[model samples]
Target: MIENYIATHLIDVAALAILCYLIYSNNILNQNRKWPFYIGIMLTVLIISSEAGTIIAGNANGDLRFLNIFCNVFGFAMSPLIPIILLAIYDVNILLTNKLLMLPSIVNMFATALSPWLGFVFYIDVNNHYERGNLFIVFVTAYILNLIILFISTVRTGQKHHYPIKAKFTALSLFVIAGTSIQLIFPSVYSSWHSVTLSLLLYYLLLSEFDGSFDALTRLHNRAAYDKMVNRLDGRKLYSVIVMDINNFKEINDTFGHDFGDTVLKKVASVIRKSFDNSSTCYRVGGDEFYIISSETDPVKLEHQLKCMTNNLEKERKNDGRLPTVSYGYSIFKGGKGIGFQEVLKEADDQMYYFKKIQQDMKKSTQTS
Candidate 1:
């Protein structure tokens, strides 16, 4: 029994030390995300301290009632926070850097901290043993509800930004859920802390990879992510590949200089993002070019959406006359169609060239008139 306690406590301590090392040793901690990283470190350290307290408090000669209380408080506190931390990881504005959105977490922490007086979250018994109080169910329910909301918000946010981090979050949530279940079923195991530590570690490692997938200029998914998305397609889902290019983008660069040209690209990216719905994936495939992939299979709905995208881009010419014009072409293929990626891209490119020619001719005719 002593050996078991020692091992669990060591693992918890090791996890905290490693996390701290990652933060201090790396430049990955930037201003936009430092708070989430700091919060994550806090969660890990609290768990480590609580677990270590549990070990020391188990000593018969030790008078560590405060340690027992701290353990219970920190333990209850960390569970509800996993979901909140996830919101921060994704850089979700509402959950991170927004005090207003933190009301739920604040309320939860306050309620959980009432374990001593109200016996709602947990309490230390006369023997200095930790025990779940009568209202423990309420805390559990609150944690579960936070997880649900986190999942919904993450998926919806990912869809809005054309990111696919929901799968990662789903995996982490499931792991925590399973670990929590096992701990509840067999209270002696003390495995949930280990699971959480490892999960947080892996999640941060994944977070580090996010920068490579994003385009620095536009903050959209870059060509690397584009390749991954295309290569990993299951071939069963209906895919619409819309290829777009700016009209005479070189002229803008030459006329206004690179700085203004960069502004144009950013503006174009914003317009494209706004035009597409959550169901579509947009990529900055190349300079002055973009690729949007959609799984919408319904012809009428798809065409309607495509038309709206077209109008959205065209409207900018009238709305802001200084914005550069863009043209696009799309080719969709379903399962068993045997259409190669290059072939479809070629088709779209061909159509784009054809459209560009028409626009050029119209300009020439209007000038001659």
Candidate 2:
């Protein structure tokens, strides 16, 4: 029995150990946020080990009955927490924001803790064998509820951040749901922890890739991501590309400092991100320059987004009098007439420079007057 248990869980534990090492060596997580991930790793390891203990003690005689009860209680009490830990790793404040989210897990823990005496969740018989009590469904319900909460949180977070890999996150959540559901339905299957370990590894890889594609300063998609998107554009679909440049950005940097300049860039990026819907992809292509690609073919809607950005910037200017305005120009591709992305980009660039020149001329006239 111990050999079978080892055979089943050895690979999962080893994979988690390697992941922990990689996370430590690469410094993949921010210093402030590393604890949740470490906690998750530790919890997963503990759960796996306790499960093995349960399997071994369940069949043994003598004083091992207490060991069997402890292992079962520990497994039942902690199983629901893995999802919560995963959610915390995604965003710790989620649990804080919704205090009620922790209620189910807390209740599960209480029930599991008392099961040895009350036998409400599970119990160990005189023969040192494990048996489920009448309210075994309580454990299953709590586990499933936490899984659902995790799934919803993942989707909402992706949408809130306008993450490009939102679908991938959704798929990962579904993968976890399916894996756990399978084990719940068929208690003989020991695939749950293994599935979770694999999911964690895959999630880390996906997040690392996603992070590399974003600009560190503005949190917008970077130049390489923009280029990749352009290359992947379907010729049969319409695309509207807008290019924007901050007015007097060099002067701002010179007068204030790079730190303030970075602040301005982040503010502008935030406005731009909020001005458009999910169909739009925003990129910071160069210093003080940004690009937006939207699938919306309607000229009026695109103009409205531009107006929205202008209004948002105006609000920022009110907060900081030194905040500069942005000049933008857009070109629309009507699909397939042999029109290339570069041509559209050049047109937008030319229009942007023309508007920028107009602004320069106006400023000079005002100064001279």
Candidate 3:
């Protein structure tokens, strides 16, 4: 029986072990981000092992009853935590900001801990037989709640980052849900950890692919991503392209430092991200230059979004006087015409330079006055 349990879990354990080695060897994530993966892998391992222990001890003599109770309690306490750890991987700040999210796990932990004595979650009888207690629903509820949170967090993160692989995330969520649900319903089948191991491996690969498309400094889509998006644009779909350049960027870099300039870029990127809706994609296409591609065809709405971006910059300036203003221009492509992307881009660029020239002339006039 113990051999059967080991045989069922051997592949999962080995997969996780290999993943842990790869994570550390490649230095895939920073220290802060890496710990969550490590913890998740560790917890899954513990849960798998304790579950096997529970089965083994439950079938043994009453002398091993203590072991049965310990294993059951440990497994129940740790099982609901896996989803929370997965959630942390996507965005640790979510857990930090929302303390209420932890309430169910905390309650489940205390209940499971006292279950051996109280027999409210699970109990091992004098004959060493394992049986569920009246309040076993506590563990089930906590696990389901955390899974829901994980699913919601994954979707929100994908949307915020404009991840093109949203279908993959959905599949992963459904995969885990199905695997865990099967085990929850069957009780005899051990499939949850197997599913988790595969999910973690896939998630790591997805993050690696997604991170490559982002600008490291500004956290916006990088030039390569921008080019890829431009090349892939459907000629039948309408697009509004907005090009913006920071005013006096060279002066800002020269007066302060490249560090301050980078900060300015990040702030501008944040403003752009907040100003635009999900229908728009923001990119840091070049030094001191940001680009926005919006699906919005309405000119008034596009103008309003641009105004919102500038207003955000003004608000940011109150905190840091060194922050520079931006001049922008936009061009609309109705598509299906002989007009190419380059043509649309050049029109926006010409207008942007014109806007910059006017701003420069006004600054000079004010100085002369």
Q: Write the per-residue lDDT of candidate 3 for residues 1-369, one digit (tens) a residue.
A: 668877878778889999888778754343455779889999988888888887788767999999888888888998888889988977899999988998889999999999988888988778888778899999999998988888788788778776676688878888888988898888778787788888889877776667768888888898988988898886788999999999999999999999998899999999998999988999999898999888887899999999999999999999989899999999999876788888989999999999999999999999999
Candidate 1 per-residue C-alpha lDDT over 120-227 given as tens digits, one digit per residue, 9 for 90 to 100:
767777677767778776667766777777778777776676667789878977988887778777867777778777777777776666656777788777899999
Candidate 2 residue-wise lDDT, 126-231, digit = tens: 8887778889999989998998898788778766555556678778878988888787778667778988999889877876665667788888889888888887
What lDDT score is found at residue 3 in candidate 2? 84
Between candidates 2 and 3, the one scoring higher on lDDT is 3
Q: Where does candidate 1 stray beyond 4 Å?
A: 1-17, 20-31, 58-62, 94-111, 159-168, 209-211, 233-236, 297-307, 314-321, 334-338
Candidate 2 local Cα displacement, residue 88, angstroms: 2.0
Q: Say which candidate scores most in TM-score.
A: 2
Each prediction's Cα RMSD? 3.6, 2.7, 3.0
What TM-score number comes out for model 1?
Answer: 0.83
Per-prediction TM-score: 0.83, 0.88, 0.86
Candidate 2: residue 287 lDDT (0-100): 96
